[model samples]
Target: MVGERKQEKDVKREKVRGAQDKGRKTERKGQKSKRTECADFTDKPRIFPAEVIAGKPVDISCTFDTTCNGTAPVLTWDTPTDVSGSISNTVTQHGVTLTYTSVLTLTASLKHHGQTLTCRVRYPSVSSERTLILTVQYAPQDLSMTSLDMINASLINIIEGNSTVIICSVKSFPASNLTWRHLNVPMNRTSSNNELWLVIPHVTSRDTGDYECVAENEHGAVEGSITITVEHAPRNLSMTSLDMINASWINIIEGNSTVIICSVESFPVSNLTWRHLNVTMNRTRSNNELWLVIPHVTSRDTGDYECVAENEHGAVEGSITITVELIICCVESFPASNLTWRHLNVSMNRTCSSNELWLVIPHVTSRDTGDYVCVAENEHGAVEGSITIIVEHTPQNLSMTSIDMINASWINIIEGNPTVIICSVKSFPVSNLMWQHLNVPMNRTSSNNELWLVIPHVTSRDTGDYECVAENEHGAVEGSITITVEHAPRNLSMTFLDMINSSSVNIIEGNSAVIICSVASFPASNLTWRHLNVTMNRTSSNNELWLVIPHVTSSDTGDYECAAENDHGAVEWSITITVECRDSSEWTAGLLTAGIMLNLFVAGILTFVYVRKSKTATEERVAEISDIELSPSPLTVKHQGKQNMLLTDPRNTTREGETSAPQGSL
Candidate 1:
């Protein structure tokens, strides 16, 4: 009994030995997916034959393959609870494949059959894993079955044209027969130690449905089922218009209703969602399809958008990207390519037919006139065409003023000083600019939006209202500004006693003289009369300065100046007034004529030569004269006027009570 126990211990030690203790074996080739005709192999881990009898020590090995290189791999094994195991790793190289194997040696029991043994290997480049369902073989009591969940095929998902492996293993010993059927039909299968592997190298929709495994012994028979549901990842993800036209990108107009419909096809419907950048959306949805609608699209809605659809089994992504544009359109391109419209090199919203593009300007104002360009392009290159549209409308915002003046309706320009009159206007189709003086057209140079009327030297002729006229084919507008030209006093002269200019005045003693001054200037020059260069009273309306010297005498002989002035400048004219004395010979001649007139004196001289005295109050008018009587002694004459009275010898002047001139020697 001691030797038998020792033999059992040796067997258990043998089961726990490394995989290299036996021999190196070539690694099995992995399966590959087909793109065209070439299939690429996949590097993954594998474990097999998941059944063992009770009280039996078994050596379980999991193998993984990778491209043969100098770098080695590391392996680990995870076993069921309370099932201690001896784990070891071995590496074998055969041609281009390097196989890494991990072995788990343990005693089998019914309590651990339903558990799992997982083998994990990490290479210098990658990592892989494989799980084995450890089913313990029980003696046939009533031929009851145990579960092999590694092949628990309620529903299996296999991509079309791809390969998959199905496992059918038994937990009972001494099986008489083992077979696999697809709808009760026999199929090619691989078997080892009451275990089978059904490999469908290429799957199709017809390969779907139940595939059953039957295990029969002398006592009873047992059966298990695997349901294969072949499917493919989502394909042909796209966006289409209402007419079902496929599109990669879409352009929509601003402030208009628009929609983007995304669709995809797969064996199973996928969950669809809309996205912009990285954020997911809770948008309009209908079973793997969605519509993004903008009832009143605005400028902020222009951007890039995406529609994504995905599913389980093998998750796949189908994406459709959309772009929104502003008010612009373009059409009439061949080779079926994308088109774009730009205003000053900017994209805008537009309407299209057969992708017909146009730039729409609804309720166009004067500001909407400019040049636009449209581009038709593909992957090769791009060609661009341009259009210039002018929106004809009435001239607007018309205003007129001088450059030196700020929004003033009137400006004062000094005479002989330079100034400018400018008018501002806005219109389409190049508005015609014009300037006018007092409703009469004046020649001017102007651009479409502004006009200038230059007055190099301002004069009275440029003092009227200047009108600025801006007109287009649609309508006309006008603005007016008054130019008040200021000038110095000019053309100063006198008009009294036919004295058109400044000159001396000869007046006998006791006689009156008159002088007047006038001038012409803007702002109605103020005229003043000055005595001996001294300023007199000033008046605006009265441009006339009267120089009336009543009862002129020698003392009054001086320069009397007349001045005209305004805010611009002033001018003056002077008159030299002189008073002369009468000769005595004239008095002797008058005495001899008085003797002849003595006979007529009784009829007319008595009435003319009476003693009379009078005073005058009118300052600008001449004083009236009174008759004087002849006297034996020299007599003096007195007169009343605005000036002081002067006295002279009686022989040289007329005296009261004198019928004739005083008799005096010359």
Candidate 2:
């Protein structure tokens, strides 16, 4: 308002000066013919308002007082933004004194600040001008917020212990005072020029939130905000204990509530959880702390309890143990006495503060199911109390065994014999043992830990793998062993000439005869052919024996026996070989051969004496017939079989086109 009044006073003074100069000039001119002279400013031309507000309208005027021969000076304006409007000119004549005034209504902007604004007054012979630098006043605008070192970081996100610099800048007439605010609350800061800077060094998780930048002046205040997020990994995990009890071991009474607390320090408010035996539990959390409550404790609820805190960075956890102990109290006697808790026969040696004794068992399995005894002894007498703890578990040490002398992999059973096989197992709460052969369940007689499978007479069909499956309420297990049935030779028979299987056979005199004996047995039973109850030949190959008699004479005809034997027993099957005797033809031919042999016999005696004398013929005759027992003593010789047989000395008598059966010892 003061600037507007000063501009009005300057305009009035210029008009008065113009009136004084024009009056003298007008008097001089009136005395002559009324002619106008070139106008000159009696008062200097002036432009009002050196400073202006941006984006607002203000009138700028330039007034000139001229020695008037009654002509007004023309005025024009030059401005920074190239603004053009009508410039009003007023010319006043007071007795030939004239004053010229020009006004331009202008709206300045920030671009016109510090630039030149000019108003020029012109006459035909004289010209004058007024120029001033424009100062623009405006509220803070075109506001921007950024980090000084980071690119496009209006909002900052960095790891913990890192640094970031934030800056707030704007355009204003009198440079704005920049301030920083957090969560809409202004923060005190040092004075700055044009721009506000917030230096956050060594940022922690507490530094994460909204931070706003405000740039203000007398005109107006403008603000911009940025978010700073500081990331810190989860760390410093702890499981706190409320009482003086150990953190890892907490013994609580039954039907009492047990609370476990876990705490951690982190950013972004870590998620907290509780777990028991790897299963999640209901938990409540507040800030960086987590808690879990377990009510009505029992032996089933005894296990490890864990607390976990998790976030985007990482996760941390802590664990504690809780148990409900078995208490055995009271050692009352005539006087005060001490008591001891023992597991079976061994002393537990765990101390307690009072008379009550506690037995704590952790992670009980099948092996831990047994009786626990507590004995209290003093100088007078000894008393005892016992408690039994049973844990249910699966079968252990399951196996199948046989009473027979056998190896680990297999059990051998002979035919027509009784064998006992047993399946046993060890487990808690009594386990049922079952027997299976090739997946077929066997009806077995079960006693305590053993199940018996009795085979009254083992046969070839019983040779297979057997399974023993033990089961309880907890689980089941199975074991297996192979059983093989053994038998002696059976179904012995003889085939005559390899073409007949019978017990008896007939043959013609001077005809060839052949017989084969075969039997079936495990471990390959030995097969033998006998004649007249005398051992003939035996072969162990394929459990078969061959008897070859090339020429069937009456001496060769007898009962031929085929026998098969193994370690178990022996069996015999006989074939009667009947040879037909020759009739009168044999008698006539024998008489003719005897008459001819009589003539040669006398001559052969002389020739035989000559050959025999050279080699002791008397001794050679005795040796040749020594094996043929003429007395028929039938010398008994015990062999590898159960029967005794006749013996003959070994000799090889080979005849052309005839093959003899195996002779003994040759």
Candidate 3:
């Protein structure tokens, strides 16, 4: 029994001794790896994306790709400022596939204005720690600009094709995108470092408007705007009338006036003026007529007349010539001789030979009584005789006694006969008794007492003026008388016709009326109408008169007057008419289509109202939630165990403009 007890104690002692040997071997292995492993850890503790955002949140962390131990090491974050707080391990393991998140807020601090933050990780067995430093900085801010305040361009300015530039210099912390906009059009953008520019090609009126620029940063935003304007001048200039000339012989009897006009076509309109030999006559638009009234003139007021037109661009001038002559005569005794008569200051031999000739004066006016003389010359020296005399004209009396002296009568002949009119007058010298028809003379007699006119198959062509003139070695005189060659009107008819449709009758609108002034008459009489309360426009047809309304309205229904007049006399006719209006509802089986259109229009309005209501409801819900989030209070807390205590914040994890809180917080 003693030997068995001693054997059990020895077995126990050997077990205890084996356990101690294993522990020593593990200790030696751990110590052996310290130096060699540290040399193998070549991954230089990197921190990715080191830029700091001012007034915003950022993540702070590093990579640890070395050491494969089961225990997690301690990670310490130390900034250049005391604003940094403790961090926790977001993910935990020992070596492979292990991650950690920061518990402290990575916000900008005063001490870390231009400095950096470093994270150091250490294992319990290692004597030194691995470190990574991240740059702690803020984004750009505070932008400045410089340029001209207002740029004024000239009147007729042009920006040659794509070469117009408006440049503005800017000073900013960071480079920004520059944009330009006009109130007339959409915005255009460009990018530069410290300056922004807006360029335009061929600037037109549409390019003139308000322009703007904007600069922004993580802290805040700022902007500026300006206005641009463009201008233009004028266009399209021209002139008026081309020519104006006075009569060759100014024969103003007495108490008469002459008026002339000149004009120009311009954008702003122009003025007219008449300049006559240093005499300026000003005229305006309303009083543009230049009137020259001569009252009972004897012999004066003769000069060159000129018309000048002026405007903003320049001036132009035109002229005409004029002359005036005198007409006067004085009475003398019966034995006194007449004034000298010069035949255009040239001499001519007498065709009729009557020796011992004496000059005789016949019935004459003041114009023909100027001068008279007679010269007789044989093969010897010439003998001259002169007469300075005054003459007066007497009105011819058409009494019975005068009618016998001057025979005058009318007679009818055959269609192709030669008609002759004779007027034998008894006076000191022969007097002219002219026979005229319609103020125009036929080829009958010229300065002779006999008239012979011939017509070949006479018709209406044989109508109009017929005259017989008589003058002998004195002043000439004329007398005219009209003759009516009656016959049927050429191209005559009595057919009822339509002017508009050429049919017997035409359909018209109830609100409109047509004046059918149709007349089928002889002698081609003129058409005339005198209608009150209705407008008139005479549209002459080949054989009809289209008396049209100025316009067609509901009140165009009344009696109309129609007249046909000729040289013989005038005749009147009358007619009453009614008007009708066009009906817009005269659709042929189209009422169903109109009904469908009205139904669709109502349905569209209902759909629009329903969509508007739905959008309003959604906006109300969003507004209520936004009010709750704006209040600074912690409603929901994310509990990420111990690591989340320093890293998690409600404001940091919320979306922009969204309400992030628990239901109770609202």
- Where model 2 places Cα greater than 4 Å from the true spot, the runs are 1-45, 55-57, 68-71, 78-88, 92-97, 106-133, 148-154, 181-192, 209-212, 236-251, 254-261, 268-297, 300-316, 325-666
Give the TM-score (vs. native) of candidate 2: 0.38
Per-residue CA lDDT of candidate 3, range 1-666, in tens?
A: 233344346446545754674576467775654322242232233334334555556665554433343556556666655564555556554423345434445766433554545556666565233333333333334433333434442112232232355654443334555555556354666554445676665655455556666654443446666555543222222222211223222332222233444444332234556666677755554222344333433335566566555555445555554343222222232333233324334442242233533222221232333334455544444455443433222212111111111122223332333444443432223344554455565454333344444444655455444544444332333333233343322332222222233323332332222344544333346665556734354323222454544234555456556665544455555554444455566432334543454356446645654675466334222111111222111111111112111111112222222332423211
Residue 444 of candidate 3: its Cα lDDT? 41
Winner of 1 and 2 under TM-score: 2
lDDT measured at residue 91 in model 2 versus the true structure, 0 to 100: 68
TM-scores of all candidate predictions against the true structure: 0.30, 0.38, 0.24
Q: Give one digit per residue, the lDDT tens place, for model 2 in 363-397.
A: 33444445667666656777777765554444555
Candidate 1: residue 437 lDDT (0-100) = 80
Show model 1 residue runs off by greater than 4 Å. Answer: 1-390, 404-407, 438-447, 498-502, 506-514, 523-527, 533-536, 540-543, 548-554, 566-568, 579-666
For all predictions, the C-alpha RMSD in Å is 45.1, 34.8, 36.8
Q: How displaced is residue 254 in candidate 3, in Å?
A: 30
User: Which of the numbered candidates is closest to the native, going by highest TM-score?
Assistant: 2
The alpha-carbon lDDT assigned to residue 366 of candidate 2 equals 42
Model 2, residue 218: displacement in angstroms?
2.5
How does model 1 score by TM-score?
A: 0.30
